[model samples]
Target: MQRVRVLVIDDSALVRKLLSTMLACDPAIEVVGVAADPLIAREKIKQLEPDVLTLDVEMPRMDGLTFLENLMRLRPMPVVMVSSLTQQGAEVTLRALELGAVDFFTKPSNDLASTFAAGAQEICAKVKLAALTRPRVRTIVRKLEVAPRLSADAVLPRAQTPDSRGGSRIIAIGASTGGTEAIRVVLEAMPPDAPPILITQHIPAAFSGPFAARMDNCSAMRVCEARDGQPIQHGHAYIAPGSQHLLAMWDGARYVCRLHDGPPVNRHKPSVDVLFRSVAATVGAPAIGALLTGMGDDGARGLAEMREGGAMTLVQDEASSVVWGMPGAAWKLGAASEMLPLDHIAARLLELARQPIARAMRAVT
Candidate 1:
């Protein structure tokens, strides 16, 4: 098998060296070259024709976003952004993803050497996954080896029985990898009066707030990071905070968001499984669950739980996903009641939301 060739582009020599060394440590990857800025990168890209790129968020001659925009417009290829763990970095990295970058990772604020070493596995895994994805296109369906990880049960116990309380229907969504953009697509199309949406997207603590803010700007529904004990209401979308697990709980009369500071489940702090299981237990048949694009199987079991609890479950079709790991796993497990393209998910959710609770419950039965 051919090794993935990667070009390291960063303004800092230390970053370039560290990124190249970490990536090279993986036998499946080869560091083709390094560039100090986008200008140098442009030349090297034409010369080396590497399979993937690790670009720094801020560069000297040209910024990463600008370079990414130009590259996608002309010659598109898989690019993973390397950014700082800061507010500014989060905003820039999100822009990079919008410009067709495959994924991103935050650089440590301090202890560069040790931090980089510690994240070597994650860094390599992202690059390798990016290589399998088409630039500015949907992700190729594939699976990667996940490290030993805890299940949603580690954070919250499985509900003994599905909760069938009388309340407004809610929507639950989970995504990773290429999810940020894919999520933007869904939110933009939703109506202002859409059902309450609970989302769990794999992100860093610094990025989730900015991500929610960005989505709020584009979505008619009010979008915000989920708060502990916050009431879930119509026309609002609650995003799971990057540092905590967000769950739905029946608060006597209405559903409310509950944030848990528990161990990471399925290697994610805001595990989709944790959120889905909670919805299955609390919202039951009236709840609608959709598993979007992601790299791993975190949400598969949770979505199945939702289906078993008589909730309508959907999975994004592989053709529209950047990585089909999560949704594909759900479909294979027979968790999804329907598989739809990215464009159709919002409409289906709204249509399902309009159904009488009894009818919606009957469809799953």
Candidate 2:
């Protein structure tokens, strides 16, 4: 098997060694070199041209953010961040994800082994997936001027409703990088009565509240941050919180949101995988899944699992994706039942939702 080349960048000698050793333990991963900071890492990147980089969030002379911004802007490469596990760490990690890092890990706590043990499968899985992801292409994003299609007029806790249309179908949306705007375009086209939407978007902790607030104002659907114990209802939209993995549960008669801080699902908290898999298990053939543009294959396998469970699945086509990694990965694996352009996504979803669920929808059943 060909090894995935990785360069470890950190100021701490112990961390550099720890990550290198742990990552190298995977037969498929190779530590090309270790650098104390970005300055040295840059020179090594030029030399080794490694397949991936594991970066520490804090460093001397130049902080990780400055270095990461330059890395993505100048020579785009897949970067997995290693961050401290503090409140600030979570905040910075989210910023790193927005700035184009493929994924992240918390600086292992003192009970490092237990922490690693809890999330090793996740870390390794994400790193492997990151290796196959496409490099990011820089684009200038302009602020939106028009209102969203699904914004709610009044607050009803999580009871807020959009259009009264009922779908025999449910839709699961997974998006990251540039997802906000992409989702807006999709939601705007939908009728007030749309399918119950459960979205897992990669967002920073500080930004999620603001993001949900922004979405609620623009879109006709009642948008709110996912809360543990909250019930999922039609006409309501759930946005996964920044630091928690949002998983759906079949609570007897209704679906409820569950918050988790267990290992990073596909290198992300509130991972698309957790949401996709849960939906796959809950609704089975009655679900319509859409994997939008993002930085990696986080949702691919989970969506594939959903498809296996007889759910209709769509992946965003490349032309419209800011970074086509997530959708492309799903496409390459034949996981997507349909490949739809971003412009057509909302309508396509509505069309699919309007259709009656059939045993034909049960690919796995």
The most accurate candidate by TM-score is 1
* Per-residue alpha-carbon lDDT of candidate 2 for residues 148-232, written as tens digits (9 for 90 to 100): 3544445444565433222146788999866765666676555546767888898767567766766676666788888998987
- What TM-score would each prediction reach against the true structure? 0.90, 0.62
lDDT of 1 by residue, 1-365 (tens): 99999999999899889999999999999999999999999999999999999998777878888889899889999999999988999998887887789999789989899999999999999999999986764222222222344558899998775453645699999999989988888888877768899999999899999999998998888999999989998889999999999999987766889999999999999999999999999888899999998888989999999989888889999988888999999999999989998878888887888788987667556
Please report how far candidate 1 places residue 281 from its true position, in Å. Answer: 1.0
Q: Any runs in candidate 2 off by more than 4 Å, and if so which?
A: 112-125, 138-171, 175-196, 201-223, 228-236, 240-288, 293-313, 318-337, 341-365
Clashing pairs in 1: 139-322
In candidate 2, how many Å is residue 242 off? 8.8
Q: Per-residue lDDT for 133 in model 1?
A: 83
